[model samples]
Target: MATKSLASCIFCKIIKGEIPSFKLIETETSYSFLDIGPVAKGHALVIPKYHAAKLHDLPDEYFADTLSVAKKIAIAQGLENYNILQNNGRIAHQEVDHVHFHVIPKPAASDEEGLVVGWPAKKPEMSELKALHEELLEKLG
Candidate 1:
């Protein structure tokens, strides 16, 4: 069954035209719009029309459509470099309950306003890696 909008969701309000947004594109299952709190000039957000709190909670077709719209936004913006970010839960920095992907177009490397990430690399034992990989593969089955 198709999901319905959550009445209290800000994104749902945007989708329903109850709230105004700088809309870029809209498909049967997804909607793309310019972010009011953008990280860069062409920063945009692609969201499924259906209200899904997490990525895994969304229907497969809706999730796929959301990603497809994000790609289209990047190409339309003429972005050579960009970041697609989706936070799943509150612990992962998800402020909004709706499932949305951020399509942030990167500027020059020196520009700090774009997508910035800190990767703290750590090398783990081969056995640890193998165990985790096996666990994930089993879950995927």
Candidate 2:
């Protein structure tokens, strides 16, 4: 569970205007701010104005608007490609409890910066894969 953590979270301060931010864009539903401690050159975080611990906690309308705002920021910022990342639980590396989307601009295959994704190879057998897929579908439903 996400307790109210306004005491030390920088993101909370950004929402409250207690700290300054290099905000690139803002909307009625969301706000896009540059990450001062960034992983890439144009690293930014898009967040809903209303505090929510996770993405799923937000209303569908708000989620859709957040994506739209993110796309606008990407275009205005000259980001040809980008990634939208939202973490949920603490085990998923969610440092901040508020609902935020990481808008990491994909480098032009030259800067060699952006979200690096990889996983150890574990080729599951066809039967195993099929069973797991079915289980996931049922769980999702």
Top lDDT prediction, candidate number: 1
Q: Count the backbone clashes (under 3 Å) in each candidate.
A: 0, 0
On TM-score, the candidate that comes out on top is 1
Q: What TM-score would each prediction reach against the true structure? A: 0.94, 0.79
lDDT of each structure?
A: 0.90, 0.79
TM-score, candidate number 1: 0.94
- Measured with C-alpha atoms, the lDDT of residue 15 in candidate 1 is 88
lDDT of model 1 at residue 69?
88
- Per-residue error for 57 in candidate 1, Å, reads 0.4
User: 115, model 2: CA deviation in Å?
Assistant: 2.4
Q: Output the TM-score of candidate 2.
A: 0.79
Clashing residue pairs in candidate 1 are none
List CA RMSD, all candidates.
1.4, 3.7
Task: Please identify model 2 stretches exceeding 4 Å from their true place.
Answer: 1-9, 110-112
